[model samples]
Target: MNIENYYNIDAQGQIVSFTREQASSFAKGIAGDFNPIHDEDHRRFCVPGDLLFSVFLAHYGVSQRMKFEFSGMVVDSTQLIFPAQLSSHMSLSDANEKNYMDIEVSGDNSKEAEFISMLSEKYVQFSSKTFPHILVPLMEQEKVMINPSRPLVIYKSMEITLDKLSGKQIELSLKEASLTNKGKKGEVRLEFAILSAGEEIGHGAKNLLLSGLREYDASQLDDVIATYTQRKSEFLAVA
Candidate 1:
């Protein structure tokens, strides 16, 4: 699938416009993210954080070492502009200049279309599986649950460091995932390794902030999982 179709971007002007439909499509189609908040009709609909990250990489390319720090949520129909010029550090903001994310890149960088596409595609697929495959078990172990009424788990930041990168295809493996709780809030860290031809070359971590967390209830958590699974199935059936 063409990445441009998923994200409407003006490369010359370095601006992006996100519609609710596109957001929902990227969540389900590309990231396998079934979070209700990404649903176009949901009350708190917001663009999937992974979608934003993927767009950035596709536009600005990838570096040997990179960091992404998110400050605000990008809502549907919002317009975002890339920095006027590429640099080691840049901030992504809306038309009003409200910063949504900060990005820093260092070391070797490649704007090659093939390299960027491969890296973004591989990393996003791994990142999106953080939900049931990783976070659910982590939350259960921690005995805390995000508010089921309006579950909010915000992508805080992510960093990747690579020894070297050069390949036609890339693979990502989850190395570890951990959660830390403080009062009603929690932080989740997902560590991963990058491999090319079965040789490890890079490492990265995705950090998320969970808010409105409460003591976990088995029944409630089960209901949440059931709902999420059903949503996935429904989408798959229609697709």
Candidate 2:
């Protein structure tokens, strides 16, 4: 879709703030698992895809490019190549151009690329009005867990008082959850964060979400297939 003309361009751009509770909730809505780590308690974890997709949705809603509606979009395909963990803060910026747009998401450095690509594609799809907003959280910072890290899930909710929110207060919240089993010993670790007006929030909510994923054991190609099958089913059933 040639969406350049349809958006309300923001040359200087604006930043959006997201709480950990908000991010976790968004991830749960999309992935159907409320991982607690992404919330307030677990000050140290995040949902990967949830963080990425949330930023994309924020761009779609806040940008001059599109309008928000229930029955909005249809995603053609989403390939998550890396993990996108959440951090304390998250933010998004929208810049318009002649033929396309440039969107930037500031989270932790770990999942920046993965988050960018996933959100980029989502941005295209949503801008074209192919699907409703994806249940993803747009964050300001992200944290990728590596090594013999104990992986956990979290779920949470928040009520921000907003003592003083000016210059476009974009409240970011996450609700979906996805966790990767320990990979090969030498693989790269992953993490992410959200940015808001060049600032970060403190002490986000969190909870463990392992019970949400079905148990499966596999190796080689067969194991990969089984895992994908289970994940596909899970993704389909989410609200």
What are the clash counts of all predictions, listed in order? 0, 79
Write model 2 residue lDDT over 169-211, tens digit each, in one string.
2223332323333332111111222224434321122222222
Distance from true position, residue 110, model 1, in Å?
0.6
TM-score of each: 0.94, 0.26
What are the lDDT figures for the candidates, one per model?
A: 0.86, 0.29
Question: Which candidate has the highest TM-score of all?
Answer: 1
- For model 2, the superposed segments whose C-alpha errors exceed 4 Å read 1-13, 47-49, 57-149, 152-239
Question: What lDDT tens digits, residue by residue, belong to model 1 across residues 151-239?
Answer: 78889999999887577568899999899999789999999999877888899999999999999887887888899999999999989
RMSD of each: 1.5, 18.2
Q: After superposition, how far is residue 47 of candidate 2 from its true place, in Å?
A: 6.2
lDDT of model 1, residue 195: 87
Q: Relative to the unseen true structure, what is the Cα RMSD of model 2?
A: 18.2
**Location of the lowest summed lDDT over 10 successive residues in candidate 2:** 131-140
